[model samples]
Target: MVQPANKRLVTEAAIETRLTTERLVTEAAIETRLTTDAASRWGAAWASGSTSRLREFFAANTGPRVAITGAPIVGTVTVASQADASALVGKEVQGGVYINTPDLELRDFRIKGDGRYALIDFGPFASRTYIHHIEFDGQQSKDTNAGLGVSSGTGPSDLRVEWNNFHDLNDAAHTRPGSSYKYNFVHDPLVWNTAAWGAYNPAIHPHTDGFQWLRGSGEVVSRNFIEVPYKSVSATPNTNSCLIIKTDVAAIDNVTITENYLNGGTRTVMVNDGGFGLPTNISFDKNRFGPDFNDGIWQYSNASSMVFGSNTWAQTKQVVPTTNGSLGYRSAQPALDPDPLGFGCVMTNLGYGAAATWGAANDARYVRALSGGLINGIEFHVTVSSGNVSVGVYRGRGRGLTHMPYDLVATSGTVACPAAGAARIAIPETWVEPGDYLAMSCDNVTMQLLLFSGTAAPLFRPLGAATAASHPLPASAPSPASPGFRMPILVGTFV
Candidate 1:
């Protein structure tokens, strides 16, 4: 028997479920079609064929988890009213999900702009929202800041954003808070490069940070990747950045950044105070930077207590300390010194690492000399509560056990605990050769030493007691019982 093209045989697999309620089944309900158009034709009472069709469709659907299916949404569907905000608990839409609402969750969609419009705009009052797993196409948008994804306004808090992808965007994300959490919040979004826009214009491109936070605190940014591209236009010849945290009025404080991969940009972080208020209580740990990425952190403002621990860059251009309040080219750190002094270079973080270890077991890691010079100072991200810690230098010769020669060139005084990021201690200058196998050791404390991820494998050696040995025991065989890992080590020179 020849079956009709529209006719189909009813089988057990075809029947999903039996409905108890009796209702008229319309042709649209049974139809299955693929659409390339952005807007879906939802024939409802409030959603007439008009300019506000997209907004009306959302206004009518008050379900907790409203799923927007079919083609893309064309125009801006602004969520302006309080009633509309209350209805959207978990609304799954396909792109163009703008938010002025509180406590909303937007996920699993591709959001493209309409040229000169923002795809995701968190209005002046949005709060407690979650944005994840969305790819934003920002090539069509006119400018960076205006057409950005996730532009936070005055009073939003308790937000967790992760796994979002962005490309060809000028401005990626930022916060405009009248205020700002604990470490409960995490941001791990991705940003790629594109040449859709021109090089730089002070009027058009004042700042195009991949991730900028003007206000609020207690949030964590980790595992995020950002690529900075070369621009086509320029007035001041600006370079696109990976992450920037700057503010004018509200005090920005207590944000923890860890384990981020940032490469190819003008600046990694521009901690701008803008003369409003200095940011305070910020920390950066376990981050990696590509070579020639310009200023690792361009500081416009001073911080009360900030930490740049376990971050790494190329060994050729190691980080240095500066007095002019900017980390240009090298991994120059402004937070390390409150008063300006062009004393020593402050190297940025790099290499494989390990978590901090306390107790009787001493912790040590292997470090290779990049450009051998006088070792004047060394700094490590040490966590402690009450006790004291002693740091030192050593020479070794082995891949495994007996890596370093059992002797100390210099050592720092035993310092007290509770040192957040300002634990940089000066040591007696010791000359070292390039490609030297050097090891950094610390006396046992009740804290952990944060590690950096690197190309080389980490090396560890455990001490038998809490106090560090000035000269370790020379071993013939590799110490199979030693604990090892790669971590950030800065060797500063006076010359």
Candidate 2:
């Protein structure tokens, strides 16, 4: 019997053992530094009457780096004042303040909309804004307006929406559960017999999409909690999904839907890609669809370039619409890999399915040799189609305790990455001794190697250059039985 060429073999026999004295760095550190800049805070007190003072405050202060907040404002505050909406870029309205603005951050506020109008109506154009940590209260029943609506137009792009809660919009026309649900009624009558909402006679928005992205790019909807009560809609269509991304004129691109908590009476995500063009580079990563999430993830369409990774389901089987999109669903658990997403790539003790990216583009960490051996091949998994990838091996040149420049060890020839699946690259042979800190870096190009995923606080190395910084391995290599940070590097030659 002969072992396969690419298979890994570990053995213990009568042989000399040479050990390196470098200590293992246990903390999970990436080379990229997280931003520590905080938004400037301004305070406001909610007063009785029109609270026009709040509106006046916004008209005065205008800057790119300022955040305003009101502790608690009473009454159903109506914001007709378009205070400095044009010049107020990167400004945030926070803490129970009700506002309507374009190109600004609407955060930490309580927005109330009457049955006749929208609570937050982002005009025909807006861009580069943040909407999060706010609560939208609508008329429990007979609410004809949307909780958050964006008219069909331009500039609803480059937005980061997260950690917001939407409930009590009462998105159904008439929800009466009992025999009172007259089937003979001429109009569509929604019936919900339960006591989910204290006000049960529901009249929902015409298009009850929670966050409607009519035309946008670089939009990320993540970690949001949306709860839509039972039997909410009667007649109007497209009122189901918590988030709807559609365009009759432009294509929605670079939208990432990840880590959301959607619980309601309707579908999860609705992508109508047929209107003008299909949504491209859409990614669904680790979202939770609750029992109330019905219909499916996508309503219907022929969308392409989608990556659906490891999502968790609660109390219901996952249902997705049939579409012509090149949908990539990672559902199977890989053998010997603890990742539920079944990505066969792992490099950490942290369970698999948690994927990381490395290279000059996403610069995270390094792959160092644990023993004295010949470097042979590099194996990795990719998600994109075909592209040129340059793989480089570097040895750290230490100068005192500070992180140092890299010395080239071996570089793989230009390799072709597949549209999907495993990629193996044979590198020019090289030797490595124990305690040598080596790094495997990819060129800043299309496609990235899937790294072991985890939530550990990352360690950072100071590159000291304008574009410097990288992950360093331990000064010493551990026993094969006690490997630390099992990165996706899996090929080494026995010396």
Candidate 3:
């Protein structure tokens, strides 16, 4: 049994050492800077074969505490680092607000495919591991491929994926748990039903993502952006929500989801249950969720609330179907019955301020004429789905208002009613704007929410000679009493 290829190299070359940035330029500074511009590129590098000299150079000069490198990688070229990582991620093209296409491949390391997904070594030249700022593309597929994978073997620790973007790859959205995936872009990397995340993994397992069975925690997936395109008539529109922490009987705690944006995903946020029960102290706050291809915030499709909310959903907007010019429809003839009668849209132009009673499928839209006073309250009514259902109101400049609101009307519901089985509720329209609002569905059943304002300040009072009809005063008519004053409260109250 001669020494294995990976083992023999580590001991003889003293590849387990450490190094620093400035040292690479020194005669005895420790690291051997190769094609890498930054000496730290090979700081703790290691690899498997003769091409692995890049890894050996970094490992032989370890001890630079600022950072540590993983096994040196080479695919199209032997370890393309420095400005190479940027190109692989498909950035610097047309990403506004700093969005990018994640297109990458890690072709050096290997994973045993025993179905258990066994771990392979990062070689010996690198004793420690660190995932640098890079991008990975999943080919818009929903498989178990990973940017960085973790198998059953290996007692590794302290890993960090920071300041990087993982988007536009349709692989599973799950990553190694217990690893800190923060301040990095984890967008649209893809989702292939990958199971469970070691979200608390600092390196291999950091012990803070609510998975406690491993007695590990403290890794987080936070403060980045996520986006998925609706498969606009293609085949499969690339999309999936944030992260998944399957119920692996692992106790996960102190998981934090904050200050990020998730746009156009038809799935749930952070999943807290997997039959193994939700990890404790799990929270989601200050995150922006917008118009998904489907629902906004989906906690569970087969279960109930698994995670609590102290979550902050601010200024984020979603476009929805409202009584606005584009979505509204006016009734050409009010002679037709618009109750719970039709199945599809029959009437049109049911614009704002119109009564909230129409058949099940009446096309109606309404608008409000305000005089700059608080909107007071709203009274809404509607029927429910005969099957399980959920309903809520949406108001926004560009988002689903129900994504975050002052009050949550109802959660789980069944049957077909809006007040009993139905919900007749009062929503505070305390402050109204030149904005728009609409009613939408939360469940996949017959959905409806009819609404009207509680009481609004009058725009102008009638002169007794006019009502909504009668001897209605003309707009340019002279007053019966004062000079220069034609519109006066002849009968209605001012306050």
Candidate achieving the largest lDDT: 1
Worst 10 residues of 2 by lDDT: 176-185
Q: Give candidate 3 misplaced runs (Cα > 4 Å).
A: 1-128, 141-155, 188-216, 229-238, 300-495
lDDT for predicted candidate 3 compared with the true structure: 0.30
RMSD of each: 20.3, 28.9, 21.3
TM-score of each: 0.44, 0.37, 0.36
Clashes of each: 37, 18, 83
Candidate 3 lDDT tens digits, 1-495:
656875777665564443443343472243223223333332222111111232123223221213323443332222134234323232221111111112222211211122111112221122123444433332332223322222212333334444343443432123433555544444333332213542222233211111112223555656444544222222232344444445564555556665455444434353555565655555555555433323334444233323444443222122222111111111111221212343122111132432222222311122221111122222333433332222222222212211111111111122233442333323222222222221222222244333332122222221111112111111111222111111111000011
Whole-model lDDT values for every prediction: 0.46, 0.38, 0.30
Which regions in candidate 1 have their CA more than 4 angstroms from the true location? 1-69, 79-95, 176-202, 229-240, 295-300, 303-305, 314-495
Give the CA lDDT, 0 to 100, for residue 371 in model 1: 41
Task: Give the winner by TM-score.
Answer: 1
